[model samples]
Target chain A: MRRLILLLPLVLFLGVAVFLYRGLFMDPSELPSALIDKPFPAFSLPAVEGDRTLTQRDIIGQPALVNVWATWCVACRVEHPVLNKLAEAGVRIYGVNYKDDNASARKWLAEFHDPYQLNIEDARGSLGLDLGVYGAPETFLIDKDGIIRHKFVGVIDERVWREKLAPLYQALVDEVTP
Target chain B: MKRFAAALLLGLAALGVAHAAIDTFEFASEADRQRYRTLVEELRCPKCQNQNIADSDAPIAMDLRAQVYAKLEEGQSDAQIIDYLVSRYGDFVLYKPPVTARTLLLWYGPGALLLGGFVLLGVIVLRRRRARGEVDVGLSQDEQDRLASLLNPTPSDKKD
Candidate 1:
């Protein structure tokens, strides 16, 4: 019994250590968001083209999609097609080009099809910081009231669109139309 | 040849002293020196994830240290300096992130687990104790009576 008492803490300590090490590698996004249902952060930046700039106002009065991307980010390349589909489906996408140089971003857009309605050049990443972006290629779904309804990190595939985005889009449209 | 060698030795000695002084000498003001030391400890060496700026031999860490000293000379407080770096770089710049809702699980999870483990152990121990029933450390009533009789017998009983 005395030996068991001595061994108990050591066993618990090892178990906890293992738990922590495993937890470190666990997908952080698996943890639910506290920012859900909150209003979208207000921001403005120069558009990818033309003299007009984009702001939070553009997303207001209509349901909108905000995609935070970077020229240097590899995942952004894969996810562009999904964004294009959303655009074709009449989703208004406001692009946040995070911390990339103008020349590279322009070159990238010229090569890959630009699907954004208005692209915000966040070369300094100030707006991305405000949006709590850890890495690029994250997407946010903003409602007509300017509240951020959902935040999606990583690549958005067709499955994600069918499962997650479609239901939310349908609900919001019904809310507005009805 | 000997004279030339002596002069070369003297030159090398002077250079060594200068280098040593640059590396080791602290400022006259204790506060400045202490602040400088603390800043070096606090600053993360991005290239060397496990090491602080002072401990890292990486070139980028050296450059960051130079920048830190430059800013310190310009009269930025510790908080101001940290905030400036955090703004430029992300939270990765800080060796330790601030404890917030996002990091509460990280900060307190271990402590909670330890407390839970203790409670579990206590329950198990108490259960074992109840199962055993309290051990009678002293003699029972019948044993005590037998012991008393054995210790002090009557005179007639002793003859038998």
Candidate 2:
């Protein structure tokens, strides 16, 4: 008992060291979305390119990636090619043109081949606010029922898509299709 | 010169106060304005993790501040406004997280650790004292005399 008591401080030190070591690799910017496992928020926003208004109902009946992107966010530009590739490979992608000018957003889509099936224009960021978007280039995986399954913050390169998002997305697609 | 410096310092201080008031919303009452200020200061900016919404210039923070002002003007209670943000942003937005099952350890861990430390120290001290008392009682008269002689080292003993 006395020997065990003498080792108590060492045990406590090791526990704290392990905790801090794990924390060092953890990304502080990757905040867990409150919307996960919940239905997507309702919105009545216009499309980026057309006059038709887009709503939550339009995004239902299929599993899709609702990607929040803006012309101002440089990371979105970096992530765009991967998104385009994903779309080419038959992935359903929807875009939230967050807080961006419609002209610029339309121009960007034209200049770089548009990857999204429908781009929701969040001009005043009201829809983005409803979705709890703090920054651009965030992606939410929504199932066929419009339930948000996962949220990934920051730029999604091919590696991120392959390693992290692809399995979850495939699972969602399989669940609905199969 | 001193008076001029003092006036300049006062002007700079006034400027600092003006900078903190980032928005000019028309509040119906002074109470509402105060509530808005408190809410912004207490809410953390999601983009800039360390800064409160009031102190951050991030666009999201600005939007949140506007949302708070709108909610306040609409006569929503403070709890309702906070709940609205918490629902979207989670409990991370609040500077003071509510006590829940997940956060019980965070709220009480330090106090528990300190209490345990004190108890452990008390036990160690009590055991040490008791051990000393036992040693004192265990010594025979002959052993006490020998210990005293070794400690004192009388003249005859030193000569040997």
True contacts kept of each: 0.00, 0.73
What is the fnat value (0 to 1) for candidate 2? 0.73
* Cα-based RMSD of candidate 1: 11.7
Best by lDDT: 2
Native-to-model Cα distance after best TM-score fit, residue A155 in candidate 2, in Å: 0.8
RMSD per model, one decimal: 11.7, 5.9
A83-147 per-residue lDDT for model 1 (tens digits): 88888888788788987888888888888878887788887766765565656678888888988
Q: Which stretches of candidate 1 lie over 4 Å from their true place?
A: A1-26, A29-34, B1-160
> What DockQ do you compute for every candidate structure?
0.06, 0.68
lDDT for model 1, on a 0 to 1 scale?
A: 0.76
TM-score of 1: 0.55
| Residues B62-98 of candidate 1: C-alpha lDDT, one tens digit per residue | 6566666766777889888787666534455577788
Position A151, candidate 2: lDDT:
97
Q: For model 1, name the residue pairs that clash.
A: none
Candidate 2 on B45-118: residue-level lDDT in tens? 99999999998999999999999999998899999999999999999899999999999999999999999989
